[model samples]
Target: MTKNERLFISPLPRYAYWLFLLGILISILLGLLFYRQVSAMVQHQAEAELKRLSASTSDQFQVYLQQTEYGMNQAATEQYIQTAIEKRDAEVLNQLLYGWQQNRNHAELWAILDKDARIISTLRGSSDNHNPLSLNGLALRAMASANPIVSTEIINKEELARVGRNVSDRLENHHLLKQEGVLTQLVIVPVLGKNGQVLGALCGGLVLNDNQELLRSLFGNSQAMHAVYQDKQCIAYFTNDNKVSFPEQISPAMTKSCILDGQACLGQMQSDGDTYVTVSRYIFNAQNQVIGYQVLALPQSQYSQLPAWVANISLLTGFLLAIFSIIVIGNTSRIRQLFDRERQRGQESYYLGMFAQKLQECTDENEVYLLLKKYLSRDLDVIQMEFNIISADDNCMESIRFTENDQVSRVYLNQSKCKPVLTGRINIYNDDRDLHCNQIDTDLIKSHVCIPFLAGGKVAGVVGLGSPQEQYWTPGRIEYLDAYLNLIGPTVTNIRLLKLLQAKAFEDQLTGLKNRHFLDQYLLEQLAIAERYKTTLSLLMADIDRFKLVNDNFGHDAGDLVLKEVAAVIRAAVRESDLVARYGGEEFVLVLPNTSTDEAVSLAERCRQAVNSLQVIHNDYSRIISVTISIGVASYPRDGNSLEALYKLADSALYLAKNQGRNQVRTAQEYLATLQRTGCDD
Candidate 1:
């Protein structure tokens, strides 16, 4: 053949070329299948990782709330705290509150409130340096609940300063005390007298704005975090590079879904010409009410490339194989690796399901932790485990260590050793020399791994595991531990939520006093005791005087303040053995066992006097309003024997007290005598 003809002619026949084309087509199909499989795997892994991150952040946020609540509650129980509050000792109260503030480095404000929910003393921290002593939404919510409550609502310090200016000309120089639109979480605990009456409340706040460290710890440097407050306002936002400014507004639909409906949402959102996977969760108060939303946004460009890169590698491998046409080895090792991964994934799925089921049955945090320990020790073969949970009151990490010998010890982590871990990074120490173990023998532990469990973008706790052999933490083992923590993070969070719900069931969210529900149950029990012991029982019904005027002139906020103040006064006036409850709006019921009509009348007079002396400053209008309450005393046996009869007589006497103008105390007998005297004159 001629040279040109030879170059053009095929070496094989037409049918052979068709066969070769078929083989190439098949190779392309297989390559596409490989790409799809790998991409799906990567996508699943990414989702799991993101969920873990969200769960961790949520856990940390809840821990902060719990710590704050605990701190306030603990302070409320202090003898000196009650004494300082009762004495209205500003210096002593400030001293105690300042010490508390110092103990909680991040606490922005600590204040002692009188039984009337009036701020008697306060200590402001660096977070909100100029935050004035004013009633904020958080304080109101806490006082209303009458229990330790963590607020999800954000308070605008500048707006508060402006409001204060209206109330006090002295606040004019404060210059709006720029809070920079930071969101704050407040914890309030009601202080109770020996009689279980709420004497006052202790409040602590943590400001979250420009809190770069918190954001970094929550999402790492690669992700984005933002906090949305009332009206869908973006109070705080942070990105990995610190360059991306948050949008002026987020998706209102998402916010409504999260805050109003209390549903977590995850979807793709576009911002600044880039797409992001945004996840949002509701921030709830101790009353189980959603107050805000926390959002995490991850740029799609960063993670979307992973699947493309994986597919491109698959295509490249196929191309190389087609060109070489050499018999490719089966790669048994690669097959085994895939099998192992699949097996591990299956195990994780199974264990996660099991853990969720078990956790659902748990009633408290301690039970959840015990379950986690069991799973780690048995299923995961962890030799020793240590958990260091952040303590908000102490502003430090508290450690709980479980050893192989079944010994449990509580201690604190050396700050120097766990600093990095606190920043939400996984810290691995392959050798004992690199590990810091002040409480444990480092020589006995050859390998250590520290993983941080985050809440609200900050380290809430650290999970540490140790092994006696060097290099024991393989990638597979690390993956297992991470998977286990994913389950634990959400489980612990649910446990906390359950407890809050349980508490709310029995609490009165409005007055911070025992609710009518508790009153009925408790009053009946107390009455039974009084009857069994042949003791006297006195009942007092009190109602705020001219509460309608406060509500009409100053608004409901002012009216609420009046109600809380009167409740506190009544509580303070009663004995420890007495029971007090909010009977209805602007009305309270008090039960005094082992007391006569005179004693009840005297107590009612004391409460009436206390309420008359109260000067409540409106939070919003900055108007100083005076409030008073009228009380009616009724004694069991003297005025009907049953609880219903006593309540009826007290109500009748309360009506007379109101009829003879307000702010007076009247007894059932006195009301009857007046009626009889008037009838005879007629």
Candidate 2:
């Protein structure tokens, strides 16, 4: 046989198969052994690197959390917050936060909340771009925690909302974790009062996205170590790396991770069987309170730079060489195609993740909704995209649609000649001449894709995506939108609930003097401090002497008028800090935290005189009526230590003043005889 034929043909028939199998077996064995060794080495090195990096990152995060806690605590305790709280001036708080947010290089946003957690002021990077960071779940959590609660996880926009807190709990909802190339960290600190109540929360963040310098600092910077601050405000350090110290800017994730994990994860590394490893720890305050967190990550490629598959192939070659011959298969082009699609999918996933992240960072639901519409319009190149907020009544959808020029239009189905895309239920279609279409009076959305916005398992609103011209819609685009709706729908519902709750809390259902509930809690706190400091604290109890007579004479309508009249008179009598709470029935309680008893009594008398001299015409019969109030004064420490006690003392005085003369001021001591005769606490 010629050389070519001989090479192509088998050299030895039976023996050749045996030898080949033996060789393959030998290669497989070698490969297995090599893979094990490589894996072990990579794991050890990766773990070491991750440990070092985690230590550095964690330390830095702790430092940043500490600084933020300090700053927020300092700010919350400042006269500014106090002044704003006293004055109920949200603008003052906003100005303060806006000033802080303007400071470049600081990853901090400041906000002040009244007791009700309303966004009084928010300071972000720019004034025009600033969004109100609504406090809903966060405020509830903050109020529940006694220490500076750290959130288990933080949404980006939420971080922008809550700028300062010492301890945190993860919000029940969390943003999807990004495990692609970009890394994120979120940290939250609660601004606490002296009584260990959460006045507000502070949030900070750090991103490890294309920031190579920060990554280099973790691996390359020698002075990097992990440190944490406890509730007692003491700093503690923990690290395996001897050479590394902390950085000024800490990632939020590290802080969040440490607080969540509970125990100190000194050198823990989790591998994804690929190139990266994550290490994390739980931080505790001096009071054994877990206030901070730290985490670090490292790339396996950092050590030796060997492909993981190399080790598997090497091990297989040594231990299971026979497997190599069997491994060679006939599928090539099909596998390559699958791999290409996967690669494209990865890229799409990355962009989608980034879009979602940015979406989560949006403080305005409308902005996010518009952004989604824009993405569907511009990114997907859809002809048009529309969103609607479903109204309570089934009349029409509140159209929240966006255009190419970023113009938003609301198409009311009832008012305009638009086709009813929805009557009472959710509807989606690609119709051109729908009545809702005419609702879009602008020429932009003549026709396009339309979807209904559902919330709380009901059709809350309708979303109409329109195109001036006819366009093709794809299943993938629809799928993307479905996902977007899934995220935004719940957020919108939550915001709506939040707004409703906020209105109920801040608004008065009746007389509107803040509220008795808010006043009793807030003023009692102020009074407590005044009492502690030996400062003057006063309370005035007033009762409209003849209020009941109005109810008897003019039916309940006239009685309601008198109550409103009394409320107006009371409001006109005192300054803002001096709260007037409707104690009960026709009586009102005035709390003056920094006023002397004499001043309080004088103020009460003014309200009394105002009510007495005021005339109300019952009818056209030309009959005029006037009412007077008996005033009671009680001073803190001199009267009683507690709110209830002061109220009782003042009420007793009021009763005595009423009995002695209908419209005169009386002190608690002056009413002591009456209290003894009545044998009642009042």
Candidate 3:
């Protein structure tokens, strides 16, 4: 044979070709396995992230509902609300409801319903011109359960009008109105009398269809899509750009699998020829019933592209290796570098996930800031960290700084440096000169970044991190910082909101004293303590004499002034250890621990004398009015053993004092003797 043919036909060369082909096949199989593993992992991570976002959105919705209910409850306890309901005054109800609705920006519509479930007045407009809003199912349920209710079932204008007409026509129909339409979520809370009787229901509506700002704030303004489904139909939808739109009546299979089943569903769906990985969760009402579904869609192209590229690169590398086996040995270091980069990325993700989990466990702003500082300083090698909390009440910035020496210092940031942050924008400083602040340590800090903590589309606070080295804040680090702030921002806002709600829950807004809720809780706790230690516990119940006359003569405004003055006097007369609460309309209760009935009588007398000496100048009438309060004193173990018994005895004594003229302090025994004398005279 010829020389060229002999070299080509050599068995050694043939074996090498077969080996090369086999190696190519093996590499293809390995690439397929790698692609599947990576794709599954990426999908899982994406789903988890989406679920977290959905959960956060759900929590924000709940908080909004809570705030609305709290505002309604506060309004329900207002003196004006009670007065308007008692006198059936629509004008007064409208004024009170409108003012309350304006004060609470979240309230869309405010209405006051009578005990018979008839709408007495609404802030929407005049009751004569606008038909009364019917008591919807949510309101009825809330009234029945004596708890707040949140419902997402939409009720349109026409249907509401029909229900209102039916309610008016029946006159005696006390059943809940059965109406559903396209309206939004409603939060209904019942207004209760002093004896815990449901006097009326207060309803606040949140129209979600046009509430783009709220949806964007809750779902995040990013490349993430969100939709709200009611009755398996898309009622509201938001795109990745935060634009509000409604999806047409097309039934999505995922809705049945996820919403109807009440389970979180994750899968891929094709829409408009583009693939998307969708995650759906059931949105529940305050009654713990599934009201609707919330769907989050992410483009599959975004995640799948990386894995596809990785697989192609593996295949190309395998082909090159088969062609040049010697080159593989030389490129080992390059392969190791790629592996190391991936490992670093994975570690960063793990750390971020861990930090987010820890952050969610924090319940206070200070704790959140401290946790952020610890993690940022340790993970990112930050030299100095500072957090500025924006006070919504005062419009001031309270700052906490952490130094390299592990020292924490609290300070205040000036208005100029905090303006940009308070404007809800991220400020990046490549050098210390960019930060025009006296608080910045220019000598120690070379670079820094400031990110705002946003909540409800507003800046709640700002977080800053500094490094001694130049160019230390990279793009990746900034992205991680953004993630951290996003998680902690809502948390801080929630904590502050909860704190405010807690204060409101126990306080009387009108009189600025503790309310009946606080009175009951504190009285029970003190009574338990008194019983355990065999200590004396005295109770005093005081009522304004002829309070209705003050309201009827001088108007409700004057009555409010009198109540405020009485509360102030009562608070002044008692010691700091004593507990004073506005029990109800024209009534105040005091719990005196370790005190006898004599001490209680003296305190009550002092309070009455202070009120009698005061000249309450009404701002509205520009007239002075004299006020007198009747008091009744009862001591634990002497008058009664239980709180209910003691309260009843004190109340009876107060009634007796009111009956025998007015303006005097009487003990439980004194009133009983007066009753006996009256019986003998009869």
Candidate 4:
């Protein structure tokens, strides 16, 4: 053959046959190994999922029982129930019961039993169970303990009829509602009179026959079914089909945990030829007491499939392996497509994870805003973006935009200006119906999309993105953008909430002045500055004259208005450098840095005159009330070294100003002069 010529060689048929057989053997061996590995992994994951389900089930029990008990206890304390019970008036009590019965979410029976265990219900309906409610049951326990009690009992047909409660009258749609016997929950909360005597018991009956609604809601799932047991007896059974009975029962160990111990249990069982990993726990009552047993049975789908496949591997070893090879070869391109798609999703998830980490480290919304600009801007080619966030105080909308210099520029706007915020949904602008958010400036960008994020069930902010391209927001980009918002939205909300809380903590609610706590921290800082720099810091202490009389005559509401008005006037007289605080009731304090006692006294005089000139309207009395204030001035490094000493001197001066005459100013020096004039004084 020439150097570039191709050579065609054919092998013998037996040689090809042996090689193919060897390939089949290798494929079969690999398949078994892979099956075992995957089965183990899936089994581990299933166990973990089972444990999680058990925890969720336990939480449901706690919440349900606690809510039921609390509701009954609150009902017992209702004024109507107490009054009717105290008066032995069945008509009024029945009226209340009738109203409660209308809400079918509540227990099957809502009635009141007298102290003698005699049914005092005015309800005309008969109980589904014929067996009478035991006198020594939940009601007796509630009355004897003088507290709410939750207990389970089996009632025969129409048992609650003795109390005038008709069981069949409620939600008769369920064929399973009527049974040979009914499992019922009796919640009893004792009603007490003014003297703390047990007047009656509020009895609630809950039917538990084939009731999957409770567990279904708790699990947020309807695909999987389970059972409830009271030892050997099944109280509730749920399955995919009503014709198929529950395939398992409570194990001996579960019985100990459920019945004897009234605690949770876990084990494995076989049901209808399928293996299940079961989680069992105690069902509780309103008193937070365990009364029954609940179970969660999840099929071991992974384990079940593994054994069957292991058997199939032997049945179709060589022939199936050859077909598998052919199938794998045929699906090579499709598998690659699947892998590429998964790789893209994985990349997106990695970026989102990093974004979430960065968002969590953010201390303020500005940092979060910066992160959005950094991460999302690159992915979406977003030329401009703005966050239309609602202020925590007034639902005020403020737009934050990034400029070319990377500086955050904020513009305040009305909350109603944004469509996404007002409508609580994402507003997409692609010339669709010629609709757009009024807040967006169309001149700045070619296309825009506004996405709203919710926190605490209300829209907290709208993230507006703009680009120089129309129809630019494709489905993929939109979905990715949603994920980005989900990560960053919570960070913005948390920062805003924290800021609101901090403002509320330091600022007074009524007067909008710095509270005592803030003043205390601020005073220490100012004092340190004065001492370190060897500068004078003057403190002005002022009091609203006859403030008590204002409250006593016009009521506290009017007094609040006077205080707010006075605070505003005082705040107007002081410079921004000066710190103003409400120092206890009707007393105001100002800390002025790098100032003389003379300047502080002058400012105090202005504050006093402003207050004297102001008139507050008490609308309730149709009165215009005139107010006056007394002021005293003290300076650091001149009057005293410490805050306490300066405050005492200022307080003494303020007392002197008030005694001398109302609506006047005094200094610590004046106080000393008066002490000398009086003589025999400290």
Best by TM-score: 3
Task: Give candidate 2 regions above 4 Å deviation.
Answer: 1-331, 392-396, 402-407, 415-436, 440-447, 467-471, 511-545, 548-682
Across 1-682, the per-residue lDDT of candidate 3 in tens digits comes to 8898888884667889889878887877776665566456655555555565555556556655665565566567765466567667887676556555544454455667766566777654545324445534666667778887777655665534432323223322322223245436777778887788887777767655444555666555346677776556565667764333334442464544442234666655566667777677765555566666677777765544232344556676566333332333333444446446545655655565666656556766777887887777667766667888778574678888766655678887665557557476766777766766665688888887778777645777778777887777788778778877876755565566556656765799899999987788899999999999999999999999989999999899889988998899889989999998999999999899999988888888889899889888887557889989999999998889987898988998998898888999889998778879878531
The TM-score obtained by model 2 is 0.37
Clashes of 3: 1
Report the C-alpha lDDT of model 4 over 1-682, residue by residue, as the tens digit: 7644544544468978889778777767776565666556555545455555555555445444454565456567655567666666777666566655543343566677766556666366322223335633666777878987766665555555455344555424554443444666666788887788888788876677656765454444333456776544565666665544553345664333232243556566666676666667766544565555677776555223344544375345755655544444444444446446645665665576667656656777788888888888767867768887787665588888888777989999888666677788777776534446665567756677889986644787888887777788887788888877765654555555445545665788889999988887898899999899988899999999999999999889889999999999999988999988999889999999999888888888888888889999888668999989998889998898888988999999999998988789999999989899989475
Alpha-carbon RMSD, candidate 3: 10.0
> C-alpha displacement of 80 in model 1, angstroms?
2.3
lDDT for predicted candidate 4 compared with the true structure: 0.69
Superposing all C-alpha atoms, what RMSD in Å does each candidate have to the true structure? 16.7, 19.0, 10.0, 13.8
Model 2 lDDT tens row, 1-682: 8888888875578988888778877776665564456446545644444454444454444443454454454455553355455455666555545434433123433455544454545443222114334332555455456345433332343443344322122222222222211123434445555565555544434432223344343324322333332221212233345443333233443334332234544332323343323344554433354444444444334443334454466554444334433332212233346346545544544455445555544545678687676555545545545565656445654666665576777755452333333353334444445525444544555445555555545556555554555433456665556555654554455445434444455445667655666667776797779967979888888888877788888877777667777888888878987777777678888888888877887887788788888887666746666788888998887888888888888888888888787799998777776667889774
TM-score for each prediction? Answer: 0.44, 0.37, 0.55, 0.54
Report how far off residue 4 is in candidate 2 (Å).
31
- How do the residues 563-636 of candidate 1 rate in per-residue lDDT, one tens digit apiece? 77777777887889888899988889998888999988888888878778878767765678988788888887
**Which runs in model 4 stand beyond 4 Å of their true positions?**
1-326, 343-347, 377-379, 403-406, 413-417, 429-448, 467-472, 530-535, 548-561, 615-627, 673-682
lDDT value for model 3: 0.69
